[model samples]
Target: MKFVIHDRNNAIKVIDSDKDQDSVVKGRFVQDVLYELASKNSMEFIGWCHKDLEDFINHDQLNSIFHHELIMASYSTTGDYEIPEAIGYIENSTTFLNVKPDVNYPTWLMSSDIGGMHAMVILKFENLKGSTKTSFDGFLNHISKTALSEGLFCYSSPGLLKKDSVSIESRQNKINLFYFVRHHYRSRWLPLLFLDYLLYEK
Candidate 1:
């Protein structure tokens, strides 16, 4: 297996080789991330993106260091919501940056391969006492569009219908969503919906 690191410029370059299809992730995911998270004996660096998409892509990679100000800028209803962060071994280079956080627990979010402004959510039903990820992109989309129209950003959106989360989202949750927005533009997200629900559907 030939692992090749293709730059964003050659996102779709073709190499006529008999080495089976090269392991390449084009434009949808952060290549560096895949390289670190994926399984391979030796895959080439083949990805798609202009550059490191953190400063302005999803939630911002580092604020001078970890551009997570958007998540931090949001105010939470919960008085003591501790902000969480993404700890990509390949991204942060080290775990020492977390400092001494009050709640140092871990968090993870996964999304299906959806695209463009669409979002996935887990609807928890008190009656059923269960939760499920919905193809609810339309709902989240409407909320985001409405929120923007109301002079708000998704980061500050509450992420629910007739309820709310403890805080905007643990800083970690918000930041992770931001990262999601950055790379997977149309993938399902774990973040809550926008603040105001203008249109409700039965």
Candidate 2:
């Protein structure tokens, strides 16, 4: 059974999840995408990673976040792919994702529009209805506290919130990525820190 939740942050973990012969080929492509994205996100956000900085989400880091549902449950549990068109939500800190599963060669060929004001991972969910409660909760938790909050009245949506048309931008070589890190972190230092520079940069 596959976890309904997915993201580029741990694309390798996802890649590692499957060990089929096909995954071998796809995994290589995913690594290339990861290399490109982790480098850009780090470089823009904190002036780290000069095309060869080794701090993209490590194996341990992936293990730490593997149980996203569990950690997020304490977080009031919540929450795509090619996603030719889906109501995507982003704030800042874009992540790379041209495709999901990245397990098939077909997906690799499909172009991606991963740019956004938020950290995004390219993913694809087949037969998503099976995990509605789990997936939706994950989705809500992902985008929660993001809409509006006068500090007193935080708003939420009962149904799925989606957009008819979505657009993607290029974050390559962009800067000030640290500026928006505060808005997304769960009021924590490590999260923002990790996103900006990962485990290294003291």
lDDT scores of the candidates, listed in order: 0.24, 0.23
Q: On residues 7-66, what C-alpha lDDT tens digit does candidate 1 reach at each position? A: 322222222123445344454323222233223322221111122211112212112211
Candidate 2, 1-202: lDDT as tens digits: 1111123212222222222221222222322333343344432211011111122212232233222221111110011222111111223312224423212111111112211111122111222223323222222223322322312111111111122223223122112223233334444643545454433333
Worst 10 residues of 2 by lDDT: 70-79
TM-score of each: 0.16, 0.18
lDDT of 2 at 188: 65
- The candidate that wins on TM-score is 2
- Candidate 1's displacement at residue 28, Å, is 5.5
RMSD per prediction, one decimal? 18.3, 19.5
